[model samples]
Target: MIVAVRRSLRRALLVAGRDLTVERRQPDGLVAALTFTVTLIFVESLAVGPVEARRPVIAAALFWIALLFAAILGATRSLERELEDDALDGILLLAGGRDALFAGKTLALAATLGIVALAGGSLALVLFDLTVALPFHLVLGVALGVIALPPVVVLDTLLALRLRARALLVPILALPVLVPQLVAATQGTAAALSGDAAASLGWSGMLLAFAIAYTGIGLTIVPAAIE
Candidate 1:
């Protein structure tokens, strides 16, 4: 049992490392995503204007909107990397099978999205000139949301690969799966910033549940789907 687990871990890390290395070598995709996210936040801040009375919810929504779109774009590019040069086929032939590839890709996707979320969130704060009562809680909410999103993003992208209008369908399929996450995140951030600790706790619990459920589904089915 130990041997099997160790082998799996090793192969998964190899897959993730390779992907990260490729990303390091060619960073245009990351740059594009960051640029798009920053531009979106800038435009939103201008529209909302600098006002002391601006609602925390508005800031939360704007932050998440940019995070959401940037995440989708990033996830698409992540999958495309595997498809290019038939790299995925070679990956699948590695010792741990499809599960290894899925595991590594999921980790890479989650990490990449997490970094983007942090950067975007920071830029949103600066753009909106916002202050919150519980900044740490807001971050936790975003972290959970990011954790939950990449699995669905990976699965749905795979499903959409065969579709004719994949670009539209990716968001269409993903948005509904993402609703619970977005709602929980938005509510949690608003509640935290408003100093409603009780409300924030409730939303955080929901966000954690959504993360666990989606992650389980992804790990269970993604490898099978790939085959």
Candidate 2:
């Protein structure tokens, strides 16, 4: 059983590696996502005038919104890339199990989103000059948001596949589903910014709950979608 598990993990990693390699070669998707995130931050900062005044409320919203859009765009293009190259069908045939495929794809999507969040979060902190108290809590909240985003994105990617008006449909479908996560994340960030550890913990716990629920559901549904 251990050997079998290892083999399965290896296969999943191989799939993820292939996806990452493709991204590295083209890089257009990553570039576009980063560009969009930066531009949105710039616009928001301009509108709000300063990070000190707006950081508490705007920071969380800004982070999640940028991540939300970036994930949608990135996931769409990643899946589309496979479909365009006629690689997905071949992968399905070779993998023999939809669960394994889902695992692989989901991991890849999560990794991609992590990178985006890291870059976007760093830029937001620097550009906005956000001076939130309880730095640890703020970091923790952002970490939670990053952790929660990918599986939701994986689920979205599966839904977007073969759908008409997918670009529009993805956000419409995903944003509503992601509201709970956004709420928790936003509240947690706000608390952290205000130096309220208790409030941040409450929201962080909520975010963790959402993450757990989403992961459980994604594991079940994503396999079917992949197949």
Candidate 3:
């Protein structure tokens, strides 16, 4: 079982490596995502004024929105790149298991979103002067939200792959599907900002369930998408 798990992890990482290599060779995807996120945060700060930006309620919404839009942009581009190069088909063939391919792509997307979330969170802290008494829960909420991205991205990617208007379709398809996650993340952040562990914990549980359900469904549908 251990060996099998290791092999599975190795295969997933191999697929992830392919994504990272492509990302490295053409850095535009990362650059665009980072730029968009930073710009949105800065604009919001400017509009709301740094002092007002510090409000826990407003800050929670902004943080989730920034991360949500940024993730959508990044995931769409990443999947579109595969489609454009016909690389996804190749991966599907070579991997011999659509579940593995889905897992790998989902991992890569989540990793990228994790980086974006970190940067966005830090920027929020600095720009908004956001103060939250519950540091641990705040961090936990961010971590949970970050972990939830993979399955969402995987499902969205499959849906967006063949859509004629992917830019529009991605957000349309992803936004509604992602509402529960956004709510959980926002509530968790809000709870942490207000120093309420119970609320944070509640949302964390919901977020975990969302991740599991989304991933399971994504994996189930990926074989059909690949075909």
Candidate 4:
């Protein structure tokens, strides 16, 4: 079992490295995600009307909106490219197994979304005067959001592709499942801003638990979906 686990991890890394290399060579997804994030932050800030002065929850709301959409865009593009080029079958053929392919794709999706979240979060904080009493908590909230959200997106995208479902259904399918994560991350950020220790602790626990759960689900289920 230990050996199998190690092999899976190594295979995942190789798959992830291949995806990363492809992304670097053709960066449409990366460019689109970052652009969407920045645009969402700027436009949403205006809609909220003065970030620092708004309700504490506003900051969390804005950040999550950008991060969520950014992640969606990246995941969608990654999968769409595969389907259009029929590269997914090639990936599976080369990957040696479905588990490795899932791991690699999950890592790639998460890394791209993570970068956009961190960049957009910093910019949103400055634009909206979203100064929280517990800045560390705010940072942690963002980190966990990236960690937990990607697997859900990747798996859903894969499932949708398997079903030949429309692109619109991806969010429709994913959002219901993503609620716990979205609520946890948003409320956790609010708690951090307000210095609510109890809320922070609870939400943080939820975030960690959900991250682990979703990642495990991705590994366990995506292969089945592919097969």
Candidate 5:
């Protein structure tokens, strides 16, 4: 049992490492996600127009919204690399099962989205002049939200793998499922900014719950769906 578990862990890490390495070499997805997110935040900040009272709430909303779109775009691009190279089958075989592949993809995507979230959050803070009253909650909210999003995105990407309009369907399918996380992240950030620790914790807890649920579903469904 120990050996089997170790093997699985090794395979998962290998898969994740491969994906990250490819991303390091290519970086198209990362570049695109960051550019889009930064641009969205900048444009929205301009529209907010020097309104200090309004910046907190609007900044929270805009940060999460931009992150949401980044998640979709980045995940789609990451999955597309496998399809473009006809590598999905090979990866599944090497990984020994779909669960490990799912896990590795989730980890790689989580890392990618983490960078985008950090960039977006920093930009939001500077551009909106947003103050973080509860820094812990704000960071926790972003971390949990980033961790929670990738599994759903991976599953959605695989489900839409054979679709004719995959680019369109990916977001359409993922947005509804991701609304809870989005809401929690936004509300949590708002709470943190407003110095409501209780509320921030509540929303962060919700984000954690959704993260578990989404990742569990992804592991359970991905194997069957991929085959």
Candidate 6:
């Protein structure tokens, strides 16, 4: 069992590395995600008006909203590219199993969305003049949120691609599942900015739990889902 797990992890890393290399070479998904996220953050801040925008709670909420949607965009593009010329089928056949494929895709999506999160957070800080009273908590919240996003996105992306109206269905399917993580990350960021250490920790823990739960679900279901 241990050997099997190690082999899976190794294959997962190779898959992730391959995806990342493709992204680095083409960069369509990353560029689009970054642009969309930054634009959404700026527009959301404007919509909330200057006074409300400066509030840590408001800023955090807006940032999270933008980041989540950007995650969807990134995940979709990554998966869609694999659909070209039946590349995904070939990858799945060689990936050892669906679990490894899922893990690899999840990791790749996480890495991509991590960049979006960082960019959005930095923009929030600048636009709102946000001060982090507990930098540790803020960082932890962001890190956990990044870790939590990918499994859900990757699963939904795969499911959506199986359908005809995938473009419209991805957000519809993903949004409801993403709400808990969104709420946790937002509240955690707000808490960190407000110096509420306990609240930040609690929310961060929630994000971590969400990550683990969704990842497990993805691994369990992916084999059947992909077929």
Query: Of the candidates shown, which would achieve the greatest lDDT relative to the real structure?
Result: 6
Q: Against the true structure, whose TM-score is highest?
A: 6
Clashes of 4: 0
Q: lDDT for every model?
A: 0.76, 0.78, 0.81, 0.81, 0.85, 0.90
Q: Which residue pairs collide, candidate 2?
A: none
> For residues 1-227, what per-residue lDDT tens digits would candidate 2 score against the true structure?
99987987788788788888988899888888888888887787777778343667787688778877887888888888878867777877775455556667767777777788889888887887777789899878877777777678767777677776887888888888988888888889889988999999989888778777887787688666764
Query: Tens digits of per-residue lDDT for model 4 on 1-227?
Result: 99988988899888788777878999899889999988987887787688342566887877887788777788888888778768888777764567887777888887888778878877877777665788777777778778888889888888888666647889898889988888998899889888986787788889989988988998888877874
Off by over 4 Å in 3: 1-7, 49-51
Tens-place lDDT per residue, model 3, 69-172, is 88788777788788786877777786445777777777887788888888988988888877788999988888889778668866776766777787888788
> Candidate 1: minimum summed lDDT over ten consecutive residues — where?
45-54
lDDT of 5 by residue, 81-162 (tens): 8888678778777546688888888888899999999898888887777778999888998898898888888889888987
Q: 4 or 6, which is superior by TM-score? A: 6
lDDT for position 21 in model 6? 99
Between prediction 3 and prediction 5, the one with superior TM-score is 5
lDDT of candidate 1? 0.76
For candidate 4, the lDDT comes to 0.81
Query: What's the distance in Å from true for residue 18, model 2?
Result: 1.9
RMSD of each: 2.2, 2.3, 2.0, 2.0, 1.8, 1.0
Error in Å for residue 224 of model 6: 1.2
What is the lDDT for 185 in model 4?
Answer: 88
- Please identify which of the two predictions, 1 or 2, would achieve the higher lDDT against the true structure: 2
TM-score of each: 0.89, 0.88, 0.91, 0.91, 0.93, 0.97
Write one digit per residue (lDDT tens) for candidate 6, span 1-227: 99988998998998899899999999999999999999999999899898999888999999999989988998888888888897888877874767877899999988988888888788889888888899989999999999898999889988777677888899999999999999999999999999999999999999999999999999888878886
